[model samples]
Target: MLSLSFLCVIAFFAGLVDAAVGGGGLIQIPGLFSALPNVAPATVFGTNKLASAVGTLSAARSYLRRVRLPWRLVLPTTVAAFVFSFVGAQVVSLIPKGVIRPTVLVLLVIMAAYTLWKKDFGKLHKPVEIGRREMAIGLAIGCAIGFYDGLFGPGTGSFLMFLFIRFFAFDFLHASAAAKVVNLTTNVAALLSFAIGGHVLLAYALPMAAANMAGAMVGTRLAMKKGAGFVRVLFLLLTSVLICKLGWDLLQG
Candidate 1:
């Protein structure tokens, strides 16, 4: 009961953070490992996905209802993300965690530094016209990041948020909102695989999913009220934490 309670609390915070700036796995993944040390890693990961998918879907729905996204871009991006994420999962064993972690850590540091350096980054919304060029760019980003999410599975949301802001000229708020949709798609794809593999633990996932949805609602409200600058700050903070966490893991390994 205590362990379940702890996981529920973690899921709530994870949803809150994820709904704001994307990095819920930073919170929930470690919590699962610590709480269920005796469980198989695949099961823990699957349960995490189940709970996270619900929270992300909740956040995505909230954003979709309130924010006006470019569906022209969103559709292709989502399809590409779902397909590539599954492909990445199929070949996950071909790559090694050691190789991926350090590379991701470096990318996070670079992304963080660039964001810090550009004071006006993600501050304004200047969406590009939907054209062949933009569509191609969106597809490329979806393929790369989707594969990364399936293969290594950290900072997927942050990466998507950054790319949306940097490439699409979306403000932090819009970027975060759009990222939720893509993130939710990836989570659902991964969750289906886990469910098929019998790795998901519904007893824990259902409760955590409920807590996560509630947190996502609260978080979406906060972001909508606070606006883009607030989300930019959150993006930086969460990315920094991810950087530090990945750094620590690499060092330990």
Candidate 2:
């Protein structure tokens, strides 16, 4: 088993990367699996959610301080995500992960290719008009991705970032900031379920949460100072990693 110190270090970097562009699970989840191979999947997932939720909140708070979010849109999206995430978690067993994995792989590929093709895709923050249609769109994005997060549990952040940029016309920075808020909501929903089911390991979760929070602070500051262009680059890199990860999983399956 890996030492707690080693896991804390992994959590730190996961927080840092997640706070910047929302791929922290790529690091933390694998570390958890490696460190706790004998543990039940529920406990592992629950612990991850607890640690990640705290880190995501830290990043969201920092982003909210500097970025002016459109609450008109953000509110509905967050609400939908929180509600539907629970629904998704309840139905997780009914859906086969085998089906979800390949679909996500294709979507990631298309998303990555489109972002690469569009030179200025997320460079500028030009929000669409806040009409009923836009609000509905936000809710739809929230519902779909939130459900996916609950059921399948990969690439939620990347998916949210891309949707925000593509539909809401947010730049990379704003999209990331917004994605943090929605992601936090979903995490909290899942964590609550796990906690109630007695799946969370508080012994590990608390320390990792603290480390993740510290990392989030540094990451948000770096992202704000560096600007949207830098975030766009990181987004692409993370998405590329997601693509490779899912593709490999599919091949193995």
Candidate 3:
């Protein structure tokens, strides 16, 4: 019971961070492992997804209300992500994640460094590019990141945000909003697999979901109010943290 309480607290803050930017796993996953050491990794992952899905769903709705999302791109990309994520989840056991870690860490480092160096990168909305070419890029990014989400399950949201900004030429605020939709699609796909496999801890997930929803609402409101500048800073910070976390994991292994 005490441990469950701790997990809830962790979920609350994780939801806040995730809603503000997109690195909830950094907080939620480690807490789950520390709190329930005996639980299988798959179960812990499943429970974390369950909690995060609720949070992302809430955030998505909030963004939809305030932000004008590129549905033409988001809708198709989300569909691709949904299908590919299921495939990725099914084949997760066959893949060796060792090779992917270094590549992912390098990419994250580049993303963080580039964002930091470019002071006015996402400060304003300047989507000078759009149409079929952009849609194609969005689909490709969604497929690639969705596969990563299902197979490895870390830094998915940050990757989505980065891709949206880079490929679609969206500002940070709009990119983050779109990323939530894609992230939610991937999360739902992963969650279904986990739930079917009986890996989720429902007892903890329910309360965590409630807390996550609250946090998402608050975070989305703040992002909408503060605009792209705030989101850009948060996104860079989250990417830096992800780089460090992945770098540490690679070193430890």
Candidate 4:
């Protein structure tokens, strides 16, 4: 078992990474598994959601205070994400994610490559279109991404950011801000299901949540200060790490 001190450190860093670009699972999940190898998979996942959701909530609040979010889009997508995510979690057992891992790998590779090639893709804040049409697109993106989050549980925020950038023409910062709101909904849905299924470990969740919240405050502030270029860079870096991680998992499987 990892020392409590060590776990706290991990949570802090995970929150920082998650708040910055939304891949805290890359850090927190492995740590939990390594520390408690005997624990059930659902327990690990539930605990992770507990920790990550706190970080995401803090980050979302921070972003909302500073960034101009599209409320119309955020509202509908948030609702859809919450509903679909719950359904996805319930049906996750019916689906085998192994079948989709290869396709996900390919998509991640392509997204990373495209981001690398386009130096200024999401650097500046630009809205190509807006209003009802954009809101509808956002809703579609949210449902798809949210379902994936509940079902397979990797790269949800990165996917959300990418879709917002491509389809709705949001810059990295705004995309990230919006992603948090949707991610929060998905996390809540999954967490609720896990709680009901008796998977969460609250003893560990509380301290981790505190650490995650602190880290989120710092990370969100930094992202806001550095602007879209820094976010774009971080997004690509996180995406690359995710691709490598998923690729390794696929290969091992």
Per-model TM-score, in order, reads 0.98, 0.98, 0.96, 0.96
Writing each residue's lDDT as its tens digit, candidate 3 over 122-231 gives 77777755689888887898789888888887788888887787766788888889989999999999999999999999998888888788878888888888888988
True-structure lDDT of candidate 4: 0.87
Over 4 Å off, model 4:
none
lDDT over C-alpha atoms for residue 251 of model 1: 77
Residue pairs with backbone overlap in model 1: none
Q: How many residue pairs of model 2 clash at the backbone?
A: 0
Q: Can you write out model 1's per-residue Cα lDDT over 1-253, one digit (the tens) per residue?
A: 9999999999999999999998998899999999999999889989999999999999999998999999999889988999888888778889988889989999999999999999999999999888999999999988988888877789999899999988899999999988999888888888877788899999999999999999899899999999999999999999989888888897798
* lDDT on C-alpha atoms for all candidate structures: 0.91, 0.92, 0.87, 0.87
For residues 1-253, write the lDDT of model 2, one tens digit per residue. 3567878999999999999999898999888888888989999999999999999999999999999999999989999999889888888889888888888989999999999999999999999889999999999998998888887778899899999999989999999999999999999998888888999999899999999999999999999999999998999999999999988887897
Candidate 4, residue 190: the lDDT equals 97
Task: Please give the lDDT score at residue 197 for candidate 4.
Answer: 94
Which digits, one per residue and each the tens of the lDDT, describe model 4 over residues 1-253?
3555677789999888888788988998998887778989999999989999999999999999989977877788888888889888999989888887888889989888888888877776777657778878878877888788888878888988888788777899999999999999999999999999999999888888899889999999989999898888899899989999889998899
Residue 61 error for model 1, in Å? 0.7
Residue 153 shift from truth in candidate 4, angstroms: 1.3
Which pairs clash (backbone N, Cα, C closer than 3 Å) in model 4? none
For model 3, state the Cα shift of residue 121 in Å.
1.1
